[model samples]
Target: MVSDRSKGEVSNVEPTVCWVVALKSEAKPIISYFELDHQSGNNIFPIYRNDKLGHSLIISGVGQINAAAATTYLASESGAPPWAAWINLGIAGSMDGEIGKLYQGVKVINPTKEKVFFPGYRFSKIVSLAEIQTLDYPTPVKKNGVLHDMEASGFIDFATRFSCNELVFSFKVVSDNSEQDMKLIDKMVVNSLIGNRLQQLDALLDKIITLSKREKQRLQIPDEVEEVFKQFHFSVTMKNQLIQRLRKWKIQFPNRSISDLVKEAKTAADVIRNIDDALTDLKFDWT
Candidate 1:
């Protein structure tokens, strides 16, 4: 994939990873209020540069809808190579912890009040996980999830459509407690607290991205080709048959070559297409 920064120039062979921020006001602390790039580019991902912290990232505007939209747009508009994963990074209110600490989200509860599990992948030896609930409105209330944020739901829903579960991650830096007024937490204060942690976050991102890229490469083999068959618009019966056949082959030969899988799948597609064509011809009857 080409980096938008260089127009069509293929910059990095490495899969691009998006670090999405929320609304302009929410993003001010990480990147400047005006510098958020909704546009596509290589250097386009929003980030804040502090002398202490190497770089911090941000997404779009706020709310679940805005968060989802921004995340969807980012996933679609690739300035960097198609990202391996979409990372939702921002500040959050924590009920159980002290301010300024960072935590990885392990579970996401929807605004409908249903608890949805969307957890981040484990990176290296570091254990970064938290259960979070997405609320319609900002709440100072603390719950079992540990932290409260505005954008992970949008990021998770959008990214999952394009990539696997391993490709989505949410890192929330605690800005204030549920009891504290969100209005009072300013950029300087955020910088003061999270500035040092950006490096850690970046390192973690690098690790996760590496793993995601590797996994994507591996799935490009037979499994993904089979997935395409199952997901593609085909007759339900044909899809089920194909899935069953593929499952049997996979079960028998745990490690099958992608070439064999592709051949088999292509043959199935050819048969299906031929059958459809024959049906159409039969439908023509005698003119």
Candidate 2:
């Protein structure tokens, strides 16, 4: 079922999609995941083929450095044949927006230091693009302005190397404000909304794919090198946890390939596995 709207040169590009979530449990909140064959199919939002759309999601936990590091590693490792775009999708706090409304971030500004960052997306209105801003702590009061979050800025720098202007997109759903009772909205509620957010996400992907087609020629797919960190080995438990985190990063930056990330996992694992050795190594460095 090809969508009549799926008009574009079937360039040999499989857009790798990444979803970024704040919490580990919040990743891929959607219950039943479906793959569309073409944009013309029965499902809503001009369905497109799953194969043509390479997708991955990430849960970088909380904070800016973690988000940036995860993103940098993910981008460096995306082993997709022709990596397409990188997307950061998750919940955010908006000052002037209502709950459940999705905003294509036009400006990513840090309220703490007044640092401004822009998304790679092309927007008509003067809006902030999605950016990761370092907040001192969870915003307790709803100040004024657009969305607020922990990690969009970190992913932007690494993602830029892969695709051009249209290759990056930031989609955020308003979850809490300074006025809302955030305690009531626990893990269960956030998880439930993730399921609902997928629908809107599909719509966003549709629009993004169309844009990618228009600027396909000017796009420059990044050729990333894999540097396996052999410093340490990880135990089974630690390995699983790291993989879980890696999976979230992949989801956030779908364009990232498993091949690129496995090395980091190995390195991280080695460090965890040889804790004493790692400590000794650190001691040696200090000594």
- Top candidate on TM-score is 1
- Which is the leading candidate under lDDT? 1
lDDT of 2 at 99: 71
Q: Count the backbone clashes (under 3 Å) in each candidate.
A: 14, 45
User: Where is model 2 more than 4 Å wrong at Cα?
Assistant: 1-15, 30-52, 80-83, 111-114, 122-136, 219-287
Instruction: Kindly give the stretch of ten consecutive residues in candidate 2 with the minimal lDDT sum.
Output: 221-230
lDDT of each: 0.58, 0.53
Residues 1-287 of candidate 1 have per-residue lDDT tens digits of 11132223222433355567774444553454213233335343343322121222445667777777766665454432333666777778877666766778877778674648665675635635777666677877767447777667767877677667766787777787755677888767766655546556656755775676576545443455455565345566877655555544544455754344444444557644533443343333243
Q: For residues 1-287, could you state the per-residue lDDT of candidate 2 as single tens digits? A: 23333323243435456444456445635312533333343221122234443544445667666666665554444443223667766667766666766667666666665766576565434333433443646665555666777766655655666665456766666777666755656777676656666655665666666666556533332232112223345466765554445444444556756455444444665433333332233322222
Window of ten residues with lowest summed lDDT in model 1: 1-10
Query: What count of clashes does model 2 give?
Result: 45
Model 1's alpha-carbon lDDT is 0.58
* lDDT at position 171, candidate 1: 77
In TM-score terms, candidate 2 sits at: 0.58
